[model samples]
Target chain A: MDVQEAEQPVKKAALSKKESKLSTLTRELKKGKHYYILMAPYMIIFTMFTVVPVVVSFFLSFFSFNMLELPKFVGWENYARLFLSDDIFMISLKNTLLFAAITGPVSYIACFIFAWIINELTPKVRAFMTVIFYAPSISGNVFFIWLIIFSGDTYGYLNGFLMQTGFLLEPIQWLRDEQYVLWVVILVQLWLSLGTSFLAFIAGLQTIDRSLIEAGAMDGIKNRWQELWFITLPSMKPQLLFGAVLQITMAFAVADISMALAGFPSVNYAAHTVVTHLIDYGTIRFEMGYASAIATILFILMVSTNLLVQKLIRGVGT
Target chain B: MALFQHRRIIKKRLNRSIPVTIMLFAFLMLFGMFMAIPLVYAINNAFKPLDELFIFPPRFFVRNPTLENFFDLVAVMGDSWVPLSRYFANTIIITVFGTVGHIIFASMAAYPLAKYKFPGSRVIFSIVVLSLMFSPHVTAIPNYIVMSQLGWIDTHASLIIPAMAFPLGLFLMKQFMEQLPDAMLEAAKIDGASEYRIFWTIVMPNVKPAWLTLLILQFPVLWGTNGGDFVYSEELKTLNYALEQITLGGIARAGVGAAVALILMIVPITLFVISQSKVIQTMSTSGMKD
Candidate 1:
């Protein structure tokens, strides 16, 4: 044993010398070949479906292509038109930003807050509350329920309630009116937003070590707030980061709800979002290039916001 | 010294104040009602007699509940050119294939990513992370182009294959797999287990909770899918698309719409109820406490 231990330093010293990058990489590959095999199936399919399409979308953004004709090399003309010339695109952009600003941070914090609060309850109650919170997200097309509530006629629930209470003389057009459409859409979006992230937060809160809280108490962590701020938040960084990504993506992709609730091109485009505009161009007009440009802009915006949030999350307990 | 010890005991017992607990309950109840009303309304509407459904100051509760709407749904669906059973079959085939494929492929990918130290893993993971930020809408046009080029338009492959590599599944699986102890893997390695055997027998069984979570997540997405832009044939269309058509049949079909909505919602919610305990249990222990 002594002789083997004495020889280990000599062996390590010989291997510590500079080696060519190619040789080292080849050696590493040989050592980890099984991992490569395991990853191959998913990587291939993911590349074909996800990576290739993203690259194609980026490439298509620079050209002027209708579905029927060959793509023309317009060289940034589409993007220039999107930003400088198209008025509706600008409106869509502003509406999208406003939606994201309200829903993104608010929904994210709401998920964490509700998860935290729910964690303090009995196990049975916790499970029940989780289902209640998560139901809106999973129930397919149930946002249509909101449409019924916000219907323009007096028979609509919201209007009916208001009339009965003597709040308004006439039934208001809640969804059709420009003033209320965005707010209605936002409210529904927030309702649906407490989804996967909320589940993750619940799981995350559950995962915190009970012993750590005891340790904190022993260290004079005085109150529940302090215990939460120091012990709970820092430990669940992975779940927090996961929840943030889900919420951010959900916030930016607000087209479906707006389309479903407010009607497409919502009463003078008050509820028009970047994604809806992309859909209009891509599907309705078949202007693939211009649509690609809109998609690229959204992609960049989401990525940048994600990066910024990630940076901020890194300092959670510092 | 005795007083100090007594104060410590009080502090430990009062992890939360009674008022705070009451306030939290109140807040949860308020939001809970906000969340519950729409769903409860849908369920209540499903059973309401047609007259009750259309009444002004629309009743929140059904005065006379009946299953006539469900029967009416069956009658309307019966009149369609294609059989309702065919649509149900189509939906089941797509959902099962899509969800099972996703769980398998995602876990396969996530295992290597979380457990192995290899070249390009970091780059690949970052790509996965980046993909999570962009909505699928961004890729829809290009994906359609790719689909047509591959002659996958109108084929079930268009739906199933794309869902197989969903980034969220991979992300969740990887995060869960990271919590596994490396020493356990090493012990398996020492026992002459092949990597495949290790992953299949050891790793897969350990991550059962994540499997359920992925199922709960992926099933609903596939279940609600209307076959998107690719599918065109009536026979190949899903139940959701069929339901959408029935719902759009307008005021004449409102009762049926509510019934179909209830039908669409029941399966996923049931799945959640069954799997939620495991999901919550899994997630509660998922935080990396370091």
Candidate 2:
């Protein structure tokens, strides 16, 4: 008690900027030490699963790694080969870009249209409509979609339905034939995107500034068409950006559909994604180094696209 | 003056109406069919035996209905790639713990990041947000290498731990946590509660809806483990793996495969029904927007 009384007067005299920061930091730490302990386990797991894997993959990219043989440092050879030698790699990259370009916007537009229509409906109807779309996303019932689309035999659901409705003369080998397989993959992805994207768009619409619509109305804008073009769309820019980025990444990175609809070696690799390619070579072929190289390229491409999208979004905003 | 006013009213009402209503209706019907047709087939056929499932023109409604498929689920499911029970158990384990662990850890990390801003806070938070931009599929190779290094292949750690820090959950949780009043936490702190104690006792009760939201949102993904190289071990397989194992059996077992899909949809659909409100709210909060 005696020591504390003497120390307060000395400490209370004044503090330099550095001392003030030191004291503030000390106080913050003392107040929040328990939060750090709580966060430690999660941080550890995040680092192990996410951060460490990223680092290991980066290093592995430099090595010519086969699972059986120890990784040997090859130093840019994998990247050089990916650029100079690999034709399939380039095909995969092109396929992914085209897929993203097509599906990304179509699905996003679908989301907006769906949300707009649902917003026009009454709440109960909107909820029911939401359930109709979102249930599939929730169930993720991939197996059933597989069943509907790819029934290889004459009696397969899609083939049978198309024939019965007279859309085709014969059953199509949707997965087996390479020429038609990419479309099949795209169709499945479109369906999945519809559910998630529509749901997200609905949420976004709900968050919009209702007053902005009113303001637009006061400016003599009274029609739905005028409202959408001038007020609604601009207000939804962030959500739109989020959906676009998400859809593109998911589109480029899609492997599950290819895996489900057409298994490995995926019908002459027609539906092969960069992801599936990495998994196939790194995992199945056990070529870790080459897989890492492919993956690094993918990482670079995705990050670059994100940067460009952000720039574009910024432009749109301003 | 009356004539001019009447003309203004007509012009206002006319105001260049759009004619896409018919097209919108057509899109609605097409999409509704696209979404509902699969589930209808799964359920309608689930109740039908082998003979009806194979019938030509495959009638929309089942001609014969039976509990035979449900009973056969246990029997035929066992005979597939891995035993159905093992894979189902695996799926259950991954879904339950992976989701629960995610909510807990993400909540903990989310609280400080959302409510408290320390030095390096924005930087750390941005990194988490950045992780969300990169799909997990892109990281599969890297994660595989890391998992192997830890000798964690063919174990629950591979499936469960990585899922715990998933960026979407963290982002959503952080956003939601920020919406909560800081006074609630402050009151608990003043009452002399520990941080963990405050989270579990004070914060968790408030966040029940979010946890429930995450549970329903995450179950399908967690349970859909496949029998790939990264997850082929007996202890590591999920219900999806079990389903794959069955379909991989020659043509005779196709019936069993359809049955498993029917079963897989049950839990997720059930979860969706129970947490319908919370799921909707979470979607409203987190779904894409400006």
Candidate 3:
């Protein structure tokens, strides 16, 4: 033991030097040669599939380049036009932001409430209930659901029901009205994401230690809602942050819901999120440059919000 | 002693009928039915004949069911403007390959992010997570242009390859891997195992729950419908996509489209049910451990 202790200092010093050198050497190979080797396939595919298009789209969003014409650079003209003159684009952004801002918090609360119920049940009942609830996230064809709710025809189910119930004297033009179309969209969006967000919340709720709740109870936190507020919410921080991002992304992109329920960009563009607008100006119109600018704006917003969310997660992790 | 006996009886009663547990189950059952009723109605309608479908009230079941729609679906399958089978094949190829490929590739990539302390790993991980927040629709035009440039437009490659770059799988796998102990890797390394060997031997065996969760999440996202019926080309269509094309754009295709939707939903639902047990097992292990 005495000999081992005496040699430990010399051996540790030598080992540190050797370790540092070897790590540097491994780092160089991994980054310079091996790293690229590992990452090359994804990078190549993503570049081919994602990056190149983004670059090309930056060009397409400019100019009056329809599908037939060669894309001509129109500088900041498309964006300037959108702000200065495009009533539809302005309306789309406003509606999109409003929907996202409102829905994010609402869903956050709904998911928590849903999760609380699931986790409170017996394991067997919880699993059974979980599968039952999650079925919707995959079940309905988006178009089918939209058609059922907003068939636009007088005989449409919702329209027929409303008329029969005497709530409306005449069948309403459900999808066409710019005022009501947005609500139909909001309803569908909320309905569709119930499964994924609820599942995520359940996962979060399951992670919380029972002991903490017991501790809270012992500390005279006798109220059930108080126990939840002080104990349950803080424990589920990782999921809280994750669910926030999921909600933000879902609410912002709401493009397909718009397309399905109200057609592309929606009537008078009331429901066209910035994304649908990007697709219109860039893909259909071939204004690649302008699309890129819009995309970059979206990318910036998404990433910054995501980073802010990650910070919240890090605080919880620590 | 009398007080203690009384308390025991009360405790047993409370245990059997815990208010929290009752509330949770009731809430779950209510919402579960709410979410499931539409699909149930769709399936019930699929087997019903046309006369039974639009009853004055609503028929939960049909007295005389027929495979007439299935027969019609089959007979009129290719006879339709777009071939149903061709469309089904296209969607299947996209969904199956995309889900499987994502699982394989994401698992591979996640190994380094979760276990390796290599430089720039944090940056790479952050980028992947941040990408999750970006709406794919914004990239629709860019992706379309890129696909056109590659001559991949309307091909399954347009759907499959682009969707394969999904970051959700990687993030899920990374989070799952973090739960594994470093001691296992250290012990394996002490035994002279290479990093790859450690990952495969030790790490791979433990991540079954994460994989199932990812598979469940990704398949529908990638292969799900995009609100159009009929791709305008008979050759490039999918069964559901073809069904979607029903119209003078409205009431005529409602029943037929509902039939197709019922059939289309079966595959994912079956896959989910088959894997759900495995998912439960893995999750239970981790949940109980934690």
TM-score of chain B of each: 0.90, 0.85, 0.79
- Compute the TM-score of each model's chain A versus the native chain A and list the values: 0.91, 0.86, 0.79
Give native contacts recovered, as a fraction, per prediction.
0.69, 0.50, 0.33
The backbone clash count of each candidate, in order, is 4, 4, 20
Q: Which stretches of candidate 3 lie over 4 Å from their true place?
A: A1-39, A50-75, A140-143, A150-154, A307-318, B1-30, B54-64, B78-82, B190-193, B225-233, B247-255, B277-290
For model 2, state the Cα shift of residue B226 in Å. Answer: 2.0
In candidate 3 the C-alpha lDDT for residue B202 amounts to 79
Q: DockQ for all models, in order?
A: 0.48, 0.37, 0.31
- Models 1 onward score TM values of 0.93, 0.88, 0.83
Candidate 2 local Cα displacement, residue B155, angstroms: 1.7
In model 1 chain A, where is the ten-residue run with the lowest total lDDT? A13-22
Give the per-residue lDDT digits (tens) of candidate 2, residues B203-257.
7788777787677656778866564456656756777766666667745666666
* Interface RMSD of the candidates, in order: 4.7, 5.9, 6.2
Tell me the TM-score of model 2: 0.88
Please write out the lDDT profile of model 2 over residues A137-244, one tens digit for every residue.
666545445655577777677887889889999898978898888887788777777654565678777777867766677788867788787877787776676666
Summarize candidate 1's per-residue lDDT along B146-187 as a digit string, tens digits: 999899999999999999999988987887898899999999
Docking class of 2: acceptable
**Cα-based lDDT for every prediction:** 0.87, 0.73, 0.67
